[model samples]
Target chain A: MDEVYLFVTKKILFNLVSRPVAWFDRHIVDGFMNLIARVIERSAYMIKGFQSGRIQQYGYVFVSGTIVLVIIFIYIW
Target chain B: MNILSLFVLIPVLTCIGIVFTKNMKQTRLVSAIGMSIQLILAGLLVYLYLAERQAGNMAEMLFTYDALWFPTLNIHYTVGVDGISVAMIALTGIVVFAGIFASWKMEFLSREFFISLILLATGVFGFFISLDLFTMFLFYEIAVIPMYLLIGIWGSGPKEYSAMKLTLMLMGGSALLMVGLLGIYFYSAPDGGQLTWNLLEISKINIPIEMQRFLFPFTFIGFGILGALFPFHTWSPDGHASAPTAVSMLHAGVLMKLGGYGAFRVAIFLMPEAAQEQAWIFLILTSISVVYGAFGAIWQKDLKYINAYSSVSHCGLVLFAVLMMNQTAFNGAIIQMISHGLMTALFFALIGMIYGRTHTRMINEMGGLMKVMPFLGVVYVIAGLASLGLPGLSGFVAEMTIFFGAYQHTDTFHRILTIMATTSIVVTAVYILRVVGILLLGPIKNDHFLHLDDAKWYERLSTITLVVAIAAIGIAPLWLSDMINVSLAPIVNKISMAGFEFTSLF
Candidate 1:
């Protein structure tokens, strides 16, 4: 009777819950985070050469210039 | 001057005043006073709008000031507020006020700091009240510009890189928005009227369904980027994590909401057919973000990063509710915006205070803070509880309404998505509890943090204001809900445009 109970308990613990939890931890959750991290890494890569990014440095100039053009267009249309 | 105009002008003038201040004290005092006055004005506007709403003119703009600014293009200097704009304007007022108090202790280049802060605020006020497209976009550009300097000059940990990353991503969004606005302008023409940039006039000119579908993504993605829509949301965590406390407060609190506002007011309203058709795409993406952000926060050690990711989740819910295309859900979306704004602001404000004292934000490094700084701990608990959608807190009502309303209006697929989004609350609860348990309630793990001081006077003022605002809105949601319901009626009723999306492109 004791041997039978021990075997049943082991099967329930391993199959019913523990394995799925382990699989989830290793695959689903980790996989999801890794995918997000890769996307973030790729995005971060786009700005790696920003030490000399002139357009970004003086974005205000372009923005203001656009504003002036829009105003001019509005006035002269 | 019209009341709507003053909300913009006063902040601009105050920003100018701060630029010339000699010391931190004078600078803070001036900005605080200015924001207080702006708050009073916002309160007055809400009162007037509510009074007008009660008088049975709920669907129309309460007060409209229109002048033909550019006769050539028919671009007018127009401003007004329906119930929705009034609520948003009032929210901006409260957040900006609390943000000023949160930054009271900053002494480095204090003058320039306040100047930039108020300038950003001026643009936010202008954007909400704008009844003309040119005015709205101008304010939008102005609002986004100051963020670069504010973050780069005064932020911490990867500030420069974060600043650059944030600016570029937002500008990319702006470019898309510009194209969409211009497309609308060129396409719009009332039955016999000449092309105009006046929102009221353009609403009468319905574009072809095909054109609306084509233009939908431009406006949706453009504004959705700022709203921290999934996949495009990477900048937000970096931005919030690197920003100074007050800037973070305003940025996450109110600035991000501009995305939802712009998307609904412009994209969905202009292209109702597209909204109803492609809502499934939005439902899937937004629900994924809602769950994804909560899970992301679970493993994060940084307090600000946790909040940042949480924001992506909550803000996703805002857009999710918008795509529901129903009255209650739409109302709930606006309520979520306001509630999340206040709650997130409070969270950041408290985080800043803790980081100041503990010199660390890692939950593992902070153990049993409740015994040391009871006030801060208590408030943090309040904000955290609110975040997890506890009843009698602001988030609870907002989210509950969204779930109920969305389930009511949508079919099987959307219903499944709604249920998926609902599970996010469980995730949120787990993470919030983990942080609260580790940081606020546990055995003291370090001696150095034993006697850390509680919140300062200014900090207390900020937290108290936010706490009261949260509780009041949660307990008695009727007043705010009434305003949102009225403004949402036309949109929910499928009245495309209805003169709400005010920006011109041609």
Candidate 2:
């Protein structure tokens, strides 16, 4: 009777807890992190293209940002 | 001489002292002593301010001293501290003190490094106490120009490119701010009088609405860029990743708070009508920043990049709460600035220490650090928990007050935005725990990591100073909150007095 109890408690219950916990941590949590990383990295890469180290490109951004602000002011006022 | 000026004077004197030192030891020792005195002065200032408040001093600004510097332009070297500035000064003091110790081992041009670092700190101290716009702008530029030398000389990982990018972006922001300030100056006397460049003087008389509408965007976005608002935040991750440990700590901890403080003090307080009208546009941008930065942090494997992105998210929350324009939210904004400042500094310091030992910042490359370096690992966990807004931590107190204040707007638009902003909390928890599990727990991935030594005495001192501050705020937030809440009354009244007919952009 004691052997049966040990098998049920240690083997069956322990597997139930450890296996699921490990599975959840590995599959759900880690996979989610990986998936999000890929998605954001793609966007970050695209954004990086606009941030070329060229002095001319930076000038364009400054000019364009000023233009956008001016337009907003005109529209709202 | 006003006592406030000493905050800047001591740092300058320390730089002079460092320049005369013969060896690295004397240089750092002098720098440490100077900053320690500065920190003690800050505590004294706080004590005096509170005691004065207790003695029924209801003046808007305490300990003000104004003197003309540029008479032609009506610019003065004015200095004062209300409760808010006092808090910011204290934050700067603690971070700079810890920063001196954190870089005790710097060997390349050690004297020059310490001098530049103290100079940078001097600008920050001056900026906080100044009430005149011209002097504030002067100090603001003084603070920013040192980063190029700091990063390009001593930094790692694409240091040159990162430094150039950071300097140019910040300079661009300053150019816009200059235009906005000059515009405000031109309209300073709408009733046709002499123009002045004092913040309190400008606030006393309302700038005409047409001019306010035109200049508000420039001022807000100028400071907002530094506060890491959305697309403009690109420089932060790269810059922080490349900067040396102490530079990253001071830059993240004390410097970025400059933006939020300026936006609240100069942009919003002086131009309440424009802020009330145009709040929607900035609110959307800040909300995107709040959520997107959290998601961005989750993708980064490098420890510094992870923390830099988290700073974007946290600082974005500061701007968001400021825009809420209520006493409670404003109080929350100030607290968030301090909390984020301390924790992010701790994060950068820990990352530096860990990188120094393991020689790599990639999480996947290191594992089970707890087995070898138990002290740093445990502190890192505590920092992570604080950042994720666990109850009994500074993060929780700040975020809860912000959300509660924001939800007071009974309109559907605010309700929806509030709910959207609230989702970032869960994302923050996910990233924090994932890093903890991967970096501290699980099996040892590198056999070499087993033999690494734990934190040194100096490193322990730096981290523990920050940790104690984090816990102090977390455990007993009420006193700080009440102080901020009292000072916020006038600003909140000014903001609320503006008519609220512009909630919906469409």
The residue pairs that clash in candidate 2, if any, are: none
- Residue pair clashes in candidate 1: B133-B503, B182-B505
For each candidate in turn, give its C-alpha RMSD to the true structure in angstroms. Answer: 9.4, 9.8
Give one digit per residue, the lDDT tens place, for model 2 in B1-506.
78998998999999999889999999999999999999999999989999999999988888999999788898899998888999999999999988988898999999999998999999999999998888998999999999999999999999997887788778878998998889988998888888988887888888888888989989988887788876577778878999999999999998999989999998999899998889988988888778877776776789998899789889999999888877777888999999999999999999999999999999999899998999999999999999999988889998988888788778887787788889889878877988999999999999999999999999999999999989999999988887777787777666666754222110
TM-score of each: 0.86, 0.86
Model 2 docking category = incorrect
Go through the candidates in order and give each one's DockQ: 0.05, 0.03
* lDDT of each residue in B1-506, candidate 1, tens digit only: 77788988899889888887889999999999999999999999988887887777855576888888789877788998887788889889999999999999999999989999999998888889887877787888888999999999999999997898788788989999888887888777735557766665555557677878878888898999899987778789889999999999999999999998888888887777777678789878899778878777776779998999899999999999888777777778888999999999999999999999999988888899999999999999999999999998899989988887777843589788999999889879877988999999989888998878888899999999899989988999888888777677656545534322221110
Candidate 1 Cα outliers beyond 4 Å, as residue runs: A1-77, B190-192, B496-506
Q: Residues A1-77, candidate 2, lDDT per residue (tens digit)? A: 99997785446533553345334433564356446557877999888888678999899899999999999999977
